[model samples]
Target: MAQVLEFRLPDLGEGLTEAEIVRWLVAVGDVVEVDQPVVEVETAKAMVEVPCPYGGVVTARFGEEGTELPVGAPLLTVAVGAAATGTTTGNGSSGGMPSAPAAGTPGTAAESSGNVLVGYGTGAPAARRRRVRPTASAPAARVAPADEPAGAAEARVAADIADDTEQSGPVPVISPLVRRLAREYGLDLRQLSGSGPDGLILRADVEYAMRAAGAAAPAAPAAPAPAAVPGPAPRPPAVPTPTAAPVPAAPAAERIPLRGVRGTMADKLSRSRSEIPDATCWVDADATELLAARAAMNAAGGPKISLIALLARICVAALARHPELNATVDTAAREIVRLRDVHIGFAAQTGRGLVVPVVKDAHRRSAESLTGEFARLTEAAREGRLSPAELTGGTFTLNNYGVFGVDGSTPIINHPEAAMLGVGRIVPKPWVHQGELAVRQVVQLSLTFDHRVCDGGTAGGFLRYVADCVEQPAILLRSL
Candidate 1:
């Protein structure tokens, strides 16, 4: 007499209604241990491999790879019998036992029933369950320690084992897609903040951080000391930095279906544009003095700085004075969301997509620390390894299109942040200095604001203040 057991899919989290089977690690008639990885599934945000809860000889695979399954759908069946020799057969139609081969050779495997682990199982025809008993004792399934009752030391041990089994390092809650993206971009997953269901790191979270970091890099070069400003100034006309070629477009003009982070970004951007009416203001600032100041600072043994970081620091200092710019519009509540701390999100570009990673407490950090952190964040962002926390809680944003040789363009406000600043390339343009038309390093600045929260006066004033800071970088030291 053999006893039979069935395994169902477990919940992965984040209101996930369904999951597509990525691959099956085990086949029918294979002896599997409890907690062993048996299958991989792709959810809306990330891919995950699930472990088996029970130890038994696999009798059937409920569904094929790529099939979507619902929660509680039977995925596999095992016969628990006292004698190992008894053969069990399943009926091909809904509720029959799977057919078995002659004793000794591997048994014929059963087809998988398409069922999503979270929301709904496929409406495929059901398979009949064959009744069978087992002779060999099946080991009890392992459960997570965190889920266990209080005061159970055994649960703690189980939890430790579970953690080790699930994650390879400190941050084990990330999805497979995030891990893959992080690896491609050379990111360390543990360093990122998770924002997904149950605190899992999603793909969008990683991409956003990478983009922010990339946008902040070129600004550092604008900071070195006059003595350390290596190369002589360009003669008369300033030469533009060459831009990289745009990514090749897909041939045939075929429709590229959106999915994952790209799909989410499209939807979010669409919703933002539809819901939020935006207004922008522009200004031209002479960054020559600022560049000179940065060079002076760099000569003092400070970390190699960039114009972007200096700009970011100035923005944070200014936001402290003008809290209105750091607020979010609550249309439903008809209120404003004013944050206490200043976390400035910078736009970075990655191979997969664009990411905006936030630097927390920008006002408090030293120039050197911020510079190093900017490097770390951007490196992680470009590699697709940003965590969820890094993507959220941004009180403001900065977009640097200057590196691409563009003069300036209005950047869309990242929702919840009342305003965003766009910085363009610096060029030597003829400008009045002390009543003389002298050539100076001039740059265009654009400020895009959520009109509901910020008035034209407030927006323009903020840009003017930024211009003052950029024109006299020495003023930034006083603010700090």
Candidate 2:
């Protein structure tokens, strides 16, 4: 008889708890091999293809596309022992499971896989051993035919599927939908203290607990009463407490939920505003020399130099002088950490939303290399194919708001990073050059920095260095 095994969703690291099903790769009745991707899920971190561990017929699917499922929820179920025993054959339709021949067989006798996932494997864990019931009294004992209910494989499967509802512990979660709902509302399952049956936390239980918590929290105390005077008070008319007028209802409007990339951006931006005491400083500089240098480099060269890449090179040189600007703060330990490697991130806008793709070891890359990497990451961003690692761990951000035709902006600092440099449009403007008025290519640069990381002097020095390179590209020769 084939034993039915359940496959649960494995954890995709980086502290993600749940994922939304973007597409289903396999159906309920299809036969699947071990380690085959069964569903494509979109987590808060990135888009991932989740693989199934068990190899056999897919008994049941738990969720539909666009439905969110929490970790440890069942992705599918498979029968393990049928192929090893040769009792099940292809093209057989006993139940809803398709009995096609599986390619990645778990092997004979102890049929199972070794590489299931990071946390789970083909067989049961060592703590819980699987025991196969004895079928006969002796080696040559009676072997029941396939028709008898006592020895029938299909009958055993039916019985096993029927008894899946009973639980041996206090965790009484039976549906993935309930888990997803609880996660979406930010409810902790471990804190599932409820009077539910068998200590199970039900939907109503979570809802009631949240309501009780809200009700128990006291509102801000009424304005403190004035201190009493020593002398007796004169007769004073009581001032009526003014009642607040009711607010009128507005017309209904469309609503959209923030769950994926948009939600991640919102959370980070809000936290940055609340935690970082940031300030912005701006200065205008002549960029005619920088543009001419880039043109010269490309004109004589094998690899064309991009404007942003040149700006990145200049930023790297400036950070070498003012290392304090390339650092983040450890609030708990109250220490300022100066990073050794300069990983620069550039802001890219996509259909998904605004995302920052980091270029690792930006200090070591040449202008041509940085230009190539930026183009690759930007294209990936447009196609929404960037991985989580590509989107994180940036030491500093260089935002070219010039692409949007803006003169200046006090853009928010990408949280945890010490500062960001915003470059504006480089256009021809009238300026006094060497005692005569001339049309010069000018640009505005702004730096929004965390005040806690460095004092204003360090910030000003870094901005001034960047402006110097922009005005006289030859200044970069010493550092290069």
lDDT of 2 by residue, 156-194 (tens): 433433343222211233223334444445444444442
Candidate 1 colliding pairs, count: 69
How many clashing pairs in candidate 2?
0
Q: lDDT tens string, model 1, 1-480?
A: 223467788776666566667689986645566567898775544456778765545656889986778877777765332222323334211121222322233331111212111111111122321111211222233333455565664344345434533454224221233444544554544455444322334455567655544554344356656655678776797778999989987787677645434554566577768877889999999999989988888888847987788888888878877888898888888898887888999988776466678999887987777888889989877755666567667889989989889997977788767889999999999999989999999999999988887689988988898999999767776776
Q: Please give the TM-score that candidate 2 achieves against the real structure.
A: 0.65
The top-ranked prediction according to TM-score is 2
Q: Which pairs of residues have clashing backbones in candidate 2?
A: none
Q: Distance (Å) between predicted and true CA of 434, model 1?
A: 2.5
| Residue-level lDDT for 186 in candidate 1 | 48
Model 1 misplacement above 4 A: 1-252
**Roughly what TM-score does model 1 have, to 2 decimal places?**
0.54
lDDT of 1: 0.65
